[model samples]
Target: MKRVYAKEDVCIGCRLCEIACVVEHSESKNAIRTYKTEVPRPVARNVVEERGPLTFSVNCRHCDEPLCVAVCIAGAMVKDEESGVVRHNEEKCVGCWSCVMICPYGVIKMKPAAKKVSKCDLCNGRTMPACVQACPNRAIVYEER
Candidate 1:
């Protein structure tokens, strides 16, 4: 199955991906409206890291044999057979951070306001992932390869 991949060499360390992710998941559909709040935390599924001249965004790999799924004691994480996407159930999550610990990429984060672990779900809808759409350098791309 295809997935979103990042080219670190091409990434410019711009946080448009982060902003887009938060806006996409915000209660208010409007991006400008969502930013007016005092908190203004978007909780993006992807995180960008800078290592000198290189930068990259990290997110869920949706691994074929995901350790997060195996480590979730609450059974909050599950993989979709049809789409090959790994998803989380906030209701089922116990906020133990087991999935976070198990994830090799360190992409998962706990949203304190939501009281649940949040990670990339590949958009899973009509719209493509916010990170992919927001990337200015075209470093992030969604494909079947």
Candidate 2:
């Protein structure tokens, strides 16, 4: 399965990944329109971490043996076989944060208002994720290696 990987050496920590992630998952469909205050808060599935000179975006790996799925007591997380994307079911979630605690990358975030967990799902139906599309530097990409 081809997965999205990062070349940390090329990353500038501009956070286009985070913006793209949030836009892709938004309900408004229109990225610009979704930014209005009336629209719900945008949640990012990928997050960037900065440590001095290095910075990189982190998201779900969709691991073959995912620890987050195993630790989710509410069974809200599932890995899609065809796409190798880990999806979250907000309805089933109990907001327990077990997945957050067990995720090695710390990519999962708690949606305080929604009372659920959110993470990258790779824009399952789209050709590419919003983050990948919005990145001007091509820091984030979807490809098969």
Candidate 3:
């Protein structure tokens, strides 16, 4: 399976990936409309973390042994064996922070308005995640290893 990977050596901290992700997941799917209209209030899945001289974008790893899936009290998170992708069920979610607390990478975030937990689902099995596609410097990539 292909997964998103970051090459911190090349990262320039532009954060275009974050912007693209918000737009791609936005309700209107238009960059101008999403920001101008604030439709659905754009949220980013991946975030760039900066060090003194280095930066890297981070998101869900979709681990082989997913702690988020195991800790989800409402049975909202599940791992797919075929795709090695972990998906969250918004309808079943109860806004419990169990998954968020258990995720070692701290990728999961609480959607306070909707009272839901949100993370990267690799763009729900798209050919490539929006973040990877929108990387201006190719610091992020989707690859099989």
Candidate 4:
């Protein structure tokens, strides 16, 4: 299965990836509208991390054996056998934070206002994820190893 990977060496940490992700997942799908008018604020599934001079983006790894799936008490976290994508169902989520605590990558994020967790879903229904496409440096790539 194809996954998103970040090449830290070339990452400039511009964080356009995060904005693109918000737009892709937003109701309006417009950068200005999403950032300006959206209520509750749409969260980016992928995040850019920086320490000193080193920077890179982080998102779900969609591991073959994801601990988040195992620890989800409400069964909201599921790994698609066919695509190998781990998805979080907001409707079924109880906001217990089990998946948040168990994710080894620490990519799962808490949405306090919505009482749900958010993580990378590989931009579902897109041929390429928003993060990968928005990466000007080509630091982030979507491909299978």
Best candidate (score: TM-score):
4
The segments of candidate 3 whose C-alpha lies over 4 angstroms from its true place after superposition are: none
- Best-matching candidate per lDDT: 4
- Flag the better candidate by lDDT, 3 or 4: 4
Candidate 1 lDDT over residue span 1-145, tens digit each: 8788999989999888988888888888567877887374667888899989889988899999888999999989998877888999989998888888889989888887666899888876835788898899999998888
Question: Tens digit of lDDT per residue, candidate 2, span 1-145?
Answer: 6566776777899987777677666776666766674245768888888899898776778888889989988888988776677878889999999999999989888887777888877777778777777777777777877
lDDT of 4 at 124: 91
Q: Global lDDT for candidate 4?
A: 0.93
Best-first order by lDDT: 4, 3, 1, 2
Name model 1 segments beyond 4 Å from true.
Answer: 38-40
Error of 3 at 37 (Å): 1.4
**Tens digit of per-residue lDDT, candidate 3, span 100-141:** 899998888888889898889899747888999899889999
Cα lDDT tens digits for candidate 4, 57-105: 9999999999999999999999999999999899999999988888777
Q: What is the C-alpha lDDT of each candidate?
A: 0.85, 0.79, 0.88, 0.93
Per-residue lDDT value at 17 in model 4: 95
Kindly report which residue stretches of model 4 are placed more than 4 angstroms away from their true locations once superposed. none
- What's the CA error at residue 29 for candidate 1, in Å? 2.3
Taking all chains together, each candidate's TM-score versus the true structure is 0.92, 0.90, 0.95, 0.98
Error (Å) of candidate 2 at residue 106 is 0.3
Which prediction has more favorable TM-score, 3 or 4?
A: 4
